[model samples]
Each structure stands twice: as structure tokens, then as C-alpha cells.
Target: MYAVYLFSITWAIVQSLPQGAPPSVCQTLMPFHGGGIRPQGGLSPYTIVPRRQGNHIVVTMTSALGIPFQGFLLQGRTPDRDIIGQFDSSSVNEGHPLDCGTPSDSITHNSPNDKNSIDVVWSPPRGYEGPVIFNATIAQEYETFWVGLESDPVHVTKRGANDPQFSFPLHNNGPTPPNYIPRQVKQNSAEFDPFYQGCSVTKLCFGSPANCVESKNCKAAVAVTVAGDKYDFELKAESSAVWVGVGLSEDDKMGDDSVVECVKRGNGIAAFMSYTNGNPNYGAPRLPNPQLGIQLLNSSIQDGAIYCRVRRDALTIVNGKAFDLIGKKYNLLIAAGSSLKQSSVGFHDLTYLASAQSQALADVSALAAKSKLLIRLHGCFMIAAWLGTASVGILLARYYRQTWMGRQILGKDVWFAWHRIFMLLTWALTIAAFVLIFVELKAWSGERNPHAILGTITTILCFIQPIGAYFRPHPGTAKRPIFNWLHWSIGNAAHILAIVTLFFAVKLTKAELPDFVDWILVAYVVLHVISHLILSLMNCIADRSSERRVTSFPMKDLGGPGRNSAYSDRSSDAPYSNFRRGLLAVYIVIILAIVIALIVITALAPIAESWTSFKSAVAPTNAN
Candidate 1:
């Protein structure tokens, strides 16, 4: 009996030992690659390996640099399913599907003793065996991350065997959809939980959700479900009315594409509206009959986030209009206002997305590059026309107006003529830039920011100056001093405000400006300040010289002073000498040179190169 018990214990030990001689492990280490339009840094590398332990199959992940990360996701499916289609439809952040057979645990961290590696074990569906395709994604906390796939998938069998030997290559899959949207499930509903494993894209503004906030404070998210044909969206903001939508085309500027939209009011009422665009222009009204099928599923407010979920058929036929969304790319548009009754004529933000991971995603990158170039050009032109040219005009009137050379070389009215010419050019450029921005944006919101308010004020001041000049009193009249004081005050005030406006423009558009533009602005400011100081010093010296002459001579003859003495006083009244005049001319020339250089650097050369490179990179070989 003792001998029999010993034999049974030995048999149990043998059975517990790893079977099949610890199936040979296949390991592949690949560096993280690819980035989005926004600037990001410090993405970590990932290592993939497949092996068998006991009776279960496991895939282990290791960080090359031993970095702390949020989590890692591993997805696998049978070889029969379309790999790309499965990838596009898989849930990424939450509510992952069981269609591919769920992992034992979706996220795992490094072991306590080993900070660089983590293991994730996945269970194959019962009765399923061999040859599976897999993909992996790694995310870092608030930093850039990477999504990698085996170039030729590593095929794993039931015994932890793989084919083509693990060669995980870094693939560029444009921007990953944002992961912030909460995965929504109906209460007590029988429908399967929607997968959040797919790529997501989101647009959001920042503000308090409890109080009505500007359109800039809104946010939106869109994602495709594991089913591939359904799309989910969430819109949140503080407003009386919020509208979220998806357009049929990649360009957000409205056009002849099907639109699916959801509107929510502050009082928690929600409605879905669909329309087929009749014209490309945003101002044009939608077609008379609105289509259907958009449904708002759930909504709630928590911690100043007004959250709402809406779902729709990605591709469908409704009201005789075909809405094709599968394997196609499009843009998402969002609009919100403080007043619930605001018209649906404007959008606050726009983002781009593709139904599947494809080259079509490059369209967003190309468009962004073009938009940056436009913004940079607009900023440079405004600086040259408003600040640079306006400064030259003011200096010409102040220092050169009463000089002997000014009256002799250009005659009495030429200085004023030159000033008027410069002012006219300033107005022309301002009008052109204003038109360009409005044309590019297409729609406007009523919420005013500090930059917008200042812009409006500067524009008003510009118009007021010309009109004020039209009513100026003639020289030598009783009210001429009053006119001179008013004109001087108004002109100086306008110039000051314009300079302030240019500074804010530079600050706001820094993303579009090159590294050197800030230095160029600083150089201009330094030169301008120096020039003004020198002019003030010259004026002070001239006044002092006239005072000394008047005190020494003391006009002895009757009639206060002789004609010769009066002539001396008049000549001494001149504010600038040849030396000062030469300096002023040099200052003006230097400023003009800087302005021209800035234009060439910011607008012409960089924009041309950027546009050329961006086009080449994103231009598709064949339209999808």
C-alpha cells in the first residue's frame, strides 16, 4: 500500500511539469515609429514573443528601454478573417469584443523584479486550434506611443508554434483615434457590449461645462465598432445647444455629401438630423427634406462634462439617398452656441478620419500643412502692412515735415502725399487679409476672445483715421491747434493699438510661424525703439539751442526784435540737421529691409517648400 501511494505521487508530479518540452519561444523586438500632426515625444519600443506554458498559449511584451507605460493591448484572430478588416473594427480602449476570443487579461505591467517586460496570456476559443494573426499597440501616459503589426503575421498554432518566424515591422498608421470617449452600453439591454478596440479621433475645447461657455470649449469623439458598419460619437460642452456631425468628404468645408448630426440642449433634450448637401458653400441651406436613422442613445452630465452618445449606420440607404461610409475617409464637424435657437450655419472645429487604416489618412496631414502656410502668410503680411509701413509713414511726418530739405526737395504738399499713399496701402492690405481669413474659415462664432476684440478695435481705428482726416481744419485757422492735437492723438493711438494687435497675432499663431519669426519681430521692435529715442534727443537739442540764442540777444530794438533777429529765430526753429536727417533715413531703410526679409522667409520660400513636400508625401497613387 505504501509503495502504491509513492508511485501515484510521482505520477502527479510528472503530469504537473510543462508538457511538450516548453515549446520553442519566438521573439521579435521592434522599435516604435509613426507620429501625428501634433508635436509629441519619447515614444517607447515594444518586444513581442509567443510561447507555451503548461497547456495555455501566451504572448509576452517587453519594453526595450525599461520605461513606465499605461498599458499594452494584444489582439489576435483566426487566419480566415480579413486581417485588415478585423483591425479596423476592433475596439481599442474599452468594451473589446469576444469575436476574436478575449485575452485572459487585456493589460499587464512589468514584474516587480523586472521593470522592462510584461506578459499577457490569451486563451484560444474552445475547440479552436492553430494559425492565428495578431497585432499589438502600446500606450504611454500623456506622451506619444506606437502601434505595430507583424509585417507578415506570425501564425501561432495550438502547441505555441508559429510560421514565418516573428518579424514585427513598424507600420505607419497615421493618427490613432482618440481614446477619451467612454464606451457606452444600454442599461439592461441584450445587445452585445460594443468594442472600443478600433482607432478613434476626437476634437475638444476647454471650459466649465456647468456654465454656458464659448464654442471653443466644446469636444467631440468618433469611433467605429467591432461590427465595422456602426459608428459611435460623443459630444460634450457647456452650451444651450450643441451640434455634432460627420460629413461624407475629408474636407470640412461643407459640400454635396451626406451629413449625420445630433443636437443636444442644456435641458437634456436631444434630436438627430440628417441632410444631403445641395451646395458646397456653408451658408447655403440644406436640401428641403431631412433624412433619418441617426439615433441618440444616452446622455448625462458629470464633473462639468456634458456627455452624450449617438450611433448610426456607417453605410445605408435612406430617403433614396445613399450614404456610403465603409472603407472611405471623411471629416467631422462640431458647432455649439449659448443660445438654444442658434442656426446650424457654423462649426466650431473640424477633424479628419478614415474608415480604415489606409493612405487616405494622409489627406488630413496635407491639408494641415496647407493651412499652416496660409496662417503664416497672413500674419507676415499684416505685420508688414500695418506695423512696418505705418511706422515709416509716421516717422516721415514727424521728423521730416518741417526740415528745410523736406520743403525744398519735395515741396510743401509732397510729405502729406507720401503719408496718404502709405496709409492707403495699409488699408488695402488690411482689407485683403480680413477677406482672406473669413473666406478660409467660411463660418464665424459670436463668442469673442481677447484677440478677436482687439482685432476689431484696430480695424475700427484704421477706418476712423481716414475719416477724421477728411474733416481736418486748415492750417493757420483759429481751430488749427485743436485739429493738430486731435489728429496727433488719434494717429498715435491707432499706431500703438496696431502694434499691440500684431504682437497678439504672433502669439496666437505661433504654431504656424517658423522658429525665426519670433527673433525677426524682436529685431524690428529693437530698431523701432532706438529710432524713436534718437529723434527725441535731436528735438531736445534743437529746442535748447533756440532758447540760448533768445536769452543772449534779448531783442534790444523796438518792435520786439529786428527782421534779422526774427530770421535767426525762424532758422533756429528747425528740429533736425543733416546728420539727424541722415540717421533717420538709415533707420527707415533698415526697417524696410527687415520687413521685406520677413516676407520672403515666412511666406514665399518656406511655404513653397512645405507645400511641395506635403503634396508629394500625401498625394495618393490612386483615388479611393
Candidate 2:
């Protein structure tokens, strides 16, 4: 009986609590469900319910995370007109409806306001009856919230009218044309124009920021807005430099262009300069005349992003020449460098915008088409130069110099002559390939990459080899040993470097080549290695046989008394007579096969289509 009495008392207390009791004033008064919440990363989910309280529509926004929101922007559109406003944090209340519809530039409203819910009231435009779509953009430090009405509309009964009423749509849908587009907001202001949206491009430099490999902060974003005859540019970058500039160019070349640069120094010291480029091929770039009608509105650095807003007239007049921006498309060049000691020549990196409408688009397309042809030609020339000419020259010098065929058909001096001619041909082809790359790239900036470095080293070594050969010492002289050592060392070094360069070239062009090309190259290398090993073994056997024959008979007897000259010649020649010829023939066949395979692969590879992926990888667009 005592336990039953205790249970009854506890149940009565629980029933009398707030959950079972009467609802709060706000809940009872504004009981309509707005919609579900669409959550975003680093942001608290929220639901907004619009209550028809008297003449105004009170919007109650409740956050699921129960964290204070820093800012709220509501953009709604009716059938006839658009409404854009923010919630007034000071007028937030639980019981009574708060007044709304105040225009302010500041987005932070009592930040960290420590309120889980806030109320905003919107006065509908006079005489609009269709469903209203509300798109809300709310934000905090690390989080952003987007809430709006979807295509489906929610209905609500009018407070006193006999007709049925409905609140604004609650789903945040994709981008659509709004009834009203906001004008350009003031520079450095928290307010942003929702209309006249533009595109943005991000470029990452080859060199890391501050030269640290792990630091990827060396990047920039170029956002452009076209408004009438005015072009507004906002450049945000992760840089420590005092100035950044954007240039408009007819081609990828930098000098023949107009530059609008922003200069910012320590302690907020700033200046804007406009310059026309002189000859870049000559001395430093000259800005003869400062541009007119270009204004730097605002510049700031926040959260590692350096923001600069600059506006200029679409038509730029410089030295009696006018450049129009509206109809004509120009390449966008962006550069950032230190402003210490007031130097503009030391740019950290340079990049151009690559898009269909960009000025550099032509260059990109041309490069794609031209590079394919150049790569094939270059590969063929390099293979002939390095593997064909050099290998044949070295082999003739090493094995065939003393052979019967070398002495008879080629004569005593013919081996050296042919070797020299082949090497000279190699030098010519190497120089041609080098020049072709320079012409294709149109610049000598990427000298630090592995491909460029190896090619440069190999070219230098190739140049030195023929010069050394010209000064080679006479045979049987004491200095001949030293000369031969130096010659062999340098020649081997050049050959090895050439092979390494070819390997890297294959790797660099792998994306552009088919899978079979790689296998073909590997087969060539393997065959070359096997042929070399066989030649070395044959050389060792010939040397041993010659030494054994010389030791078996006394030198005087072999030349003088009982030595049959014919027998001596036959014994000396039998060991390596036909073997060297057979091996050389096999080596020639292998080389021809490799060359044919390379040609076939190059012909079959889709070099032109590969550029599409390359362009997409390098050029990316970020839109909000």
C-alpha cells in the first residue's frame, strides 16, 4: 500500500510538469510548421516557420545545434516583385512578434547573441498573391546555413480573412533568375550583391609559397564582374607581397598589354597604378603612362586571403589607342611579387586564365595541336641521335675497328671517319630538338623541372665530346692512354645521361601516349641491355683466346722459324670470326624494331584528345 501511494505521487508530479502542461505563448500562437532543414558542413541546421500575426509575417528561425548565429540574410521573391532583408537581432522575442524589414550593411548582428531561436517579421509587398520563395543565407565563423522554400508550397489560414493564406517556400533550390538583382555593394563592405553573379578561377603556382614544399599557400583567385561599361575585378590571394596586378593581353605574351596594379605596403599604406607595357624582350618592363579611370576601391587581408577590389571603365584609352573590353576577349594575366624596395620585376610566379572566352585560349589550343606534332618529331630525332648515331659510333670504334671487314671494305681510317660523321649528325639533331622545344613553349621559365635539367646537361656533354675527340692523342703515345680514358669516360657519361633523359621524357609524355608505347620502350631498353651484356661477354672471350694463343707459342718462333703465318692468322681469327658479325646484325634488327614500334605507337595515340584532360586539369572554375 505504501509503494503504490509513492508511485501515484511521482506520476502526478511528472504529469504536472511543462511537457504535459499548457504550451508556451510563442508555440501556441505560431504553431505552423515551416519545413525541414537542409544541413551544411560546419553549420548548425535550422528551420524557419512564418506565422501570420496581424499585418506582418513573423519568421521564427530555430537552430538544431542551439548555437547563436552570427548573421542571417533572407531573400524572397513573389510573382511580381522580390524582397531582400535580414533579421533584426535586437527585436528578437519569444512571446511578441519582432519588427523586420530594416536595411543595413553590417551582417554581424549581436554576434554570439547566445540565442537558439530568433524572430524576424517581413511585411509582404502590397497586392502579391502567388507563393513566395524565401532563400536565407545564414553564417557563423566556420559554418554557413542555407534555408529556403522548395517548389512545393505550404498553406496557412489567414488570421481574420475568409480566404486561405500560405507562407513562403522553404526549400533552397538551385540558382534561378530573381525578380530583382541587387546593385554593386560598397567595397570592403559586408553586404554583397546577389545579382550579376560572375565566374572565378584559381591558380596554384609551381613553386610553393615561401619555397616550402609542404606549404600550398601560393594561390590566387580571379573573380570578374561585368556591369555595363565598367569591369569590376576582385583578386584574392594567399601571398605576403605588397602588390598584385591583373593585365589584359592580346596574346599569351605579357609585354603588349595594359596592367592595373594594386600596391599595398606595411601599416595600410596603399596606392594604385596603371601601366602600359613596353618591350619585355629588351630591358625591364616600362610603364610610360599611368592609366586613367581606374580606381582601387578597397583592399584587405583576412583569414590568409588577400582581397583587392578594383574598378575600371570598359574602354581603356592609352597614348591615343583605345582598348575595348566588352566585345573583344583578352587574355587575363595575373602576377604577384614583393614590393619591398619598390621593385616590380621580381615576380614569384605568372599564370594566364585559360578558358574559351579568355585570350590565352588560342595559345592553349595551338599548344595542344603543336605539341603533339613536336613531341613525335622530337622523340624520333632524339632516338636517332642518341641510340642510333651514338650507339653505332661507339660500337664501330670498339669491336669493328680491328675486324677483317673494317680493314678491307672500310679501310684503316674509314671507321674513325664514319664515327665522326655519325656523331656530327647526332649533334645536329640534338640541337634541332632543343630548339624545337624552346619554340613550342615560347618561354624558358621551366628550367628547374627534371626534364629540362637533364636535357640541358646531356646537350652540354654532347658538345664537349666532339671537341675532346678533335684533340685526341696519337696512337702508341704515352698520353694516348690518358686520352682514351678521358674519351671513354665522357662518352659513357653522355650516353647514360641521354638514356636517363629519354626515360624521363617517356614518363612526362605518358599521359599523352598509349599504354603500348611504354611497353615498347621497356622492351627496347631490355633488348639494349641484353645486347650489351652479350657484346661484353664476347669481348672477354676474344681477349682470353688471343692471350692463350700468344702464350702457347714464343713471340720469335711465331714470327720467325717454324711458325706458319696462315695457321697463326686462322687460329687468331677463328674465335671471333662470324660471331661479331651475327651479333651486330641482331643489334641492328632490334634497333629497327624499336624505331618501328615507336612510330606505330605515336601514329595510333590520340594526342589531340589528350589535351582536353590536360586543359581541364590545369583550368578549374569555382562558382557560388
Candidate 3:
């Protein structure tokens, strides 16, 4: 009988809990399956009291007339019933915090024990300055509950137009624009909120993950709102990043753009405007412009995230380019890095994104990263051009020159025919890869990395090789020797340069390849050198053996013309066919293996992530 009583209490406890979970819905705070029952309509024994604490509002849900309620669901909201701020998670235990859209958006009771009051630390929503109130639902028993209990109204601090700090002079300050006023002055840090509050609806907001802002879970985001001649930009980096910035560019590329950034130094956060001179290596990347038209509104550093609000001119000139935020459509560049030295920041190795299309600076949308198809194609084609086709072509022309003497391919010596085929394949792939990259960038890449310049030179050399081969003198001509020397020099130099360019490609920020890719390239180079050395040794041995055979076995017997011809051939030549073919097979296999490896790496440039996803797809089979 005691056990049955215990089971009944356990069942009641479960039945008395609110619906869904901790973050109770704004409309339905009552327990699920209680719709059939009517709530108490008389004066609720509960009342809510709200107290102000700086920028936050602390709400108290307690007995109005000394009546203790067993359970309650509490939330703060604006006038239109939209859930406003999140309750602090640490302040609630029995009634856990809920994640409606933002973290701790709602809090409700999970236990059934009676209590006089539940004090939930409710704070106002970030960036929201409208009036707010706390409404709570209290339940005395499983079947008895009260709804529509309300608290006194509270108003958040607003930035009025008459505020002197926000007023700006209409005329330009000569070459200098307005300076940034630090929010560190106001000493008002609570105004710092998620930058995505007014995203897309009232501002031009963009960031990574595309949906981060809409989902209320942005890692790095920017929202720009038009306010007369001035624009309000709220930026957020949901990480311990040293800096985060947004820039206006004519194209998707990073250089020649105008950047406004917030750097976190020591304990304070500040915003600044700078220009990147287009070439990463040619000039300083972060050239601070104290005269730029930028103003700091508010900023904060909490939980390692960097949030700042700033105002910028709608029309200004940066890097000699007329930056009319309201008139011109522009591609946006958002970047952040881990290190900062004064005004200069380290490479945007953490998060670098370019918008998919150009938009008027005042337009509203999330940041969609430009498609990387062209970039991927460019890398793959280059790998095939240099690593696979070019290497094989060079090998054939080097070692197989004398090996395929008897075999004819397309009316030419087999070695010469195959060599031409591979070389032309290399030429075609290289040219296509070159063209594709230009098409992707729409201009000559002004990146600071050497890969661009090195690849271009390699392409030029590869292009001249085929043209030079086509115009070569006949084999017996005096100039034939010169042609062969030039051809060898150019081909070898181009091949070496191409290999080195591939090495530099691994270091490119846009490449997104891991450092281990350098080791892969190193292995390819080592294997290629070893293969060449083996072939050279074999060629020398074959020559020595041929010489000894010819000297030892002399044609002493006089014979007729046909027989004499055959004997002469045997005496002059090395044994033609079998061993060289076997050697070629081994060489080709090794080359193909390396080529396939590089191609795989290029096609899946971000290889580790791809591998993880692949493993996840096949994990069930392995488990089984």
C-alpha cells in the first residue's frame, strides 16, 4: 500500500510539470493536457514585482496575499507580447532556463514542491529600448492554476536624436572625416547586445553560416542601420577573436577595400577605420586613418565575445574610391583574426567571408559566402596540369628516347608520340586552369602570396614549350642541337617552378588546405627524384652491357645482303623490348598514384571536414 502511494505521488509530479520543457511557450504556460480544465478566474493569489538594476530588470513572482504557489512559469516581454530578454540560467535551478530563440529566453518550474516566491533574474533583450513587463502563470495544484498575472511596466534607456554625442557636422573636415568616440566614456556597457537584433528587418546584416543571424546564433555578424546622414553598424564576434571587421569592396576579393574594425586590446574594446592596399605583401594591410568618417557608439567584452556599435558616414572617400553607402552597390568583406599588434591585425585565418553578390550598403540580407566552385576547379586543374601530365611528359622525353626504337605509334616513334601527347595534355590543362582562375577573380589577383606570380610564370613557360617544339628544326639540322637544349632547359625549369608553386599553394588562406598537404607535396618530390635516379642508373647499365656484347660477339662469317643486314642490327643494338617496358610500367604506376592523391586533395581541399562527413555517413555500417 505504501509503494502504491509512492507511485501515485511520482505520477502527479510528472503530470504537474509544464508542457514541452523549461522554455515554456509565451502563449501556453500551463501544463499540457490541462486545457480541458478551467483555471481559477478570481483574483490570483499571486502578483509580480519588478526591480531595476542598472541596465537589467530583476523580476519577482511571489504571493500577493500570503498564498504560496507550488509552480510558476515566468518571462519578460515587450508591449506586443514578443518575448524580449533571457533569464539568467544560474539564477534558476528547480525551474530551468529555456532557449526559445536566444539562450535562456524563458524560465519555468520543473518541480512540484510549494513555494512563496520564485525570483528569476530577468534582463531586457539586447538592442531593444522599448517598454517591457513581466507576466507569469502560477499554479497552486495539478488542476488549479492562475493566468494573466502581470507586473509593473519598465522602460529601457533609449538613444534620442537630441543626444549631443550622436550629432555630427554636415561638412567634411577637409581630408579628415569624423573621428570615433569611444563608448568607454559613457561607461554604459549593458547597451552592448547581439548585433543581429534588427537584422534584415531594419538593417543590412550579414555574417557567416548564412543562417546564424536568423537563427539567433551568429558567430560573427554585422548589422548596418541607416540613420539620416549617419549609419549605425553593430558588429559581433561570438568568440575570443582579437578583432572583427567589415569592408566595402568593388569585387569579392579583399584588396583595395575599405575596412572598419574593432580591436580588443588588453581589457578595452575600440573601433577604427583602415584601408588595405590590395596587395597583401606590397603594402601595410592595416593603414589606420584617424580622419576616416567613423564614430563609436557602444562596445563590450564579455564571455570572450567582442561586440561594438558604431556610426559611419553614408558618403565618404576611402583609398581614393568614392564610398557612397546609399548610392553604390558593393560586395561586402567580413574578416577576423586571432592576433593583433596595435592597429595591425594578423591574417584573417579564423573567419574570412565574401558576399555572394553586390548590394547597396543600406540593403538588408545575411552574408552568403561566394561560391568556391571556380577556386576548386582552379586548384584541381593546376594539380593535374603540373603534377600529373607535366611530370609524365618530362619522364617520357627523358628516359624512353632510345627504348621504343622498334615500336611505331601513329607513324612516329612510340616514345616521341606519347611524349607529345602528354606535353600537349599538360599545355591544355595549364591554359584552362589559368583562364578559369582569371574568370573567377574577374581581374589579375593582387594577393600577397607568391603562388599567383609563380603560377603565371610557370604557365608562360609551359605555353612557350609547345610553340617552341612546333617550330623546331629537323633532327639532322645543325640548329636541331640548339633546339633540343632550349627545349630541355625550358621544360625542366617550368616543371621545377610548377612544383614549387604547388608548395606555396598550401599556405594560401583561401586554399583552406591543412599543413599536412605540404608533407604530401614533399613526398611527391622525393619519390619523383628517386624514380629519375633509378631510370638513369638502369640506362647506364644497359649501355655498358650493350657495348660489351657488341665487342665480344663479332660478325666473322661473310654472308649475303639480307643476312648481313640482320647481323649488323644485332651487333649495333641493345636488347630492345622487355626490361624497358617493365621499368616504364613501374614508373607510370608511381606517377599515377601521386597524381591521384593530389587530385583527391584538390577536389576535397578541406579534406578533414570531408573525411569526417564521409565517416559519419559510413559509421552505421562499421558499427553493425
Q: Per-prediction TM-score, please?
A: 0.45, 0.45, 0.58
| Model 1 lDDT per residue over 549-588, tens place | 3221111211132313523433333545776668867987
Residue 262 local lDDT, model 3 = 86
Model 3 residue runs over 4 Å out of place are 1-242, 253-256, 276-329, 337-351, 360-366, 442-444, 548-577, 609-624
Residue-level lDDT tens digits of model 3 in 1-624:
423533543454456564423433455554432212334444556667777554456677776466777777776767776666778867766577777667777777767777887777776654566676666767776546666566666666545432211111242212111111111234222222334444565467777534444545445677776655676677777575888888888888777777888888677677888876664352225554643798876566766888777778988787667888867888877777777765576667566678888987655555567887888888988888888888887887776655555678889867779889989999998999899898887766644588999999999999999899899876546676677678888999999999999999987766767789888889889888987887766666765766632221112111122322322442222454466678678767877887788778877756765665566568789999
Instruction: Supply the global lDDT for candidate 1.
Output: 0.45
Q: What's the CA RMSD for each of the models? A: 19.0, 19.3, 18.5
Per-residue lDDT over 485-569 for candidate 2, one digit per residue giving the tens place of the 0 to 100 score: 7777777788888877776665442213544566666776787778767766776676587664322121222233333332345
Count the clashes in each prediction: 12, 7, 1
Worst 10 residues of 1 by lDDT: 20-29
Considering every candidate listed, which one attains the maximal lDDT? 3
Query: Order of all candidates by lDDT, from best down to worst?
Result: 3, 2, 1
- lDDT, model 1, position 228: 25
lDDT at 365, model 1: 24
State the TM-score for model 3: 0.58
Worst 10 residues of 2 by lDDT: 27-36
